[model samples]
Target: MRTLLDLVLPLECAGCGVPGEQWCTGCSRALYVPPVVVRPRVDPGVPCWALGTYSGPRRSGIIALKERGRRSVARPFGRALAEAVGHLRVAGEIDPPELGSLVLVCAPTRARAARARGGDPVLRCARIAAEQLAPETVLVPELLRMSTGVRDSVGLSAGQRQSNVAGRVEVVGVRRSRSDNGGARTGSCTVLLVDDVVTTGATLAESARVLKDFGVPLAGALVVAHA
Candidate 1:
């Protein structure tokens, strides 16, 4: 049975107008045909990897997931992100052990924004991607949280984006255990920050800084698309 929502608004490829598919095979082929490796001008060491540029179906699909309430699209998006991770491995950009040991950390969404969207789209994507990547992989969706009133970075200049998110996000949850001597155990896990898109690299960079305070280092970042 077709879903009422689908019946009301027929499903079509976001990249090309094809009936009954969100992302067709042709677009998927385009997404990773040429691996998109962005040497972050902001932070060189943490090279960014994306499945495709944020245009056409990629951008439309992302917007559908975040703003248009198409949460079902996350499955394909997650698999694509996993594919990007595989690309990193194939290019020798990431070691196998590190990839297995790394935790997936989803970018933080503002409290109000998450409520309005019904849930955290990025976190869902991160969780799904982790599942696709490896069975043993852990996902720390709430590792970071943005401060209230942090404005969305859309349409903002790079400098403006930096200022908007500066001092506005921080680590919230780090598990602590008592040692034999009753001392607290510090965080010792590496994270792979995941986001829907990477533009100015401000958000991922800022997330790395916040995680550093808690003794968690980021191996790199993965995203569905790049701008």
Candidate 2:
């Protein structure tokens, strides 16, 4: 069915711009490489992993999904993310509590930006990745939100980015824990932050801080690419 639509509309691959396929095999292979540990300017106080650098196919696919409205490319990206998660689990980098699931918490986007883009692409990719890991994994898409007045982080310095999100990322719908132990018990679920790209890592840092304030401890963070 997609091939037929491609024939009629002549769609291009979001990664390589090759005609017919939404995401070509070569580009898919590029994202399938081993996930690597990355250090951003602002630490999120947890391990951070990225599938690839923000370049070539990875960069192109992200731009297409977020700016060009080419959502079809999300599947391959999500598959790559799932593969990274599986590898981390096998490698002992991500250890869920016994009898608990690995929970993916998508990095929040502005409601206005999400509306303009039809939806939140990061959340969409996370959802797809969670589906691939279902029964053992879950997705919490609304755990965080960007407060109003937060400016876009593009072209901002690391410090500026940090300032922009400082105290501006809010935890949503999560009740404050009454325990003095300082960590919320989320059904024994191990939480992992999910995002499409990480630049200065300010957003992730702020997100983790806010979630912590709400007593949700993050195990780590995962991204499609690191700039």
Candidate 3:
């Protein structure tokens, strides 16, 4: 019945005007066919990778996914990010364990933002990608908190960016009790931070700093796009 309804009440492609598919193949191909790798100095401690440049169709697709309620579009977007990270792996940029023991940690959104969106968008995307890349990767939601009254991260200069995120984000809900399975002594594990988009590396850098302080081995960062 639902399938029939979907066929009848056509949904235009979020990427293109093509009917049926949420995002047409052509547009999806254009989304992240060739992901970009950026190495700005601000992203210290943890290596950061953004899938696509924030321009042209990629920018439009991301805006639609974030602001226009095209939440279903996250699947393809996550795949693109995973692919980008995989590309880095092949290029010897990021090194996952031989057994591929890695955790996917998402940067937390403000309480109000989560309430407005009904859920954390980056977490949602991370889960989808983790599922698709399952067995090889594990999803860890061990980052974030309500606002620390930090200054708004927008329009800040590079130096100001460093100061703004300093000591603002904290490590809140990580379990330290050792399990039967021996991992890190603090129960802190290797983690790769995930986010939807990054303009300035301020937010990502801040999150990485907090995770490093928590004694979690900083692996890398994954995001859908860079601005």
Report the lDDT of model 2 for residue 4: 40
Encode model 2's per-residue lDDT on 1-227: one tens digit a residue: 23343355667788888987788989989988778999999999999999989999999999988997677777898888888888888788987436456778988887789889878888888888887776654755578889898888889999999998889888776556455443535647778999999999999999999887777878899999999
Highest-scoring model, lDDT = 2
Off by over 4 Å in 3: 1-10, 32-34, 155-161, 176-190
TM-score of each: 0.84, 0.91, 0.80
Better of 2 and 3 by lDDT: 2
* Better-scoring candidate (lDDT), 1 or 3: 1
What would the per-residue lDDT of candidate 3 be over residues 107-210, giving only the tens digit for each residue?
75666656676567677677777776666755556467646566655678877876876777777776655463334542544467888777777777888777
Off by over 4 Å in 2: 1-9, 96-99, 177-184
Clash count of each predicted structure: 0, 0, 0
Model 3 clash tally, residue pairs: 0
What is the TM-score of candidate 3? 0.80
Worst 10 residues of 2 by lDDT: 1-10
lDDT of 1 by residue, 1-227 (tens): 23355457888875566887877887676655435777554562465677778888788788877887677667677777777667776787766645346578887778888889868888877777778877656555587899986897889887888788888887776553444321122134445788888888878778878776556666778777778
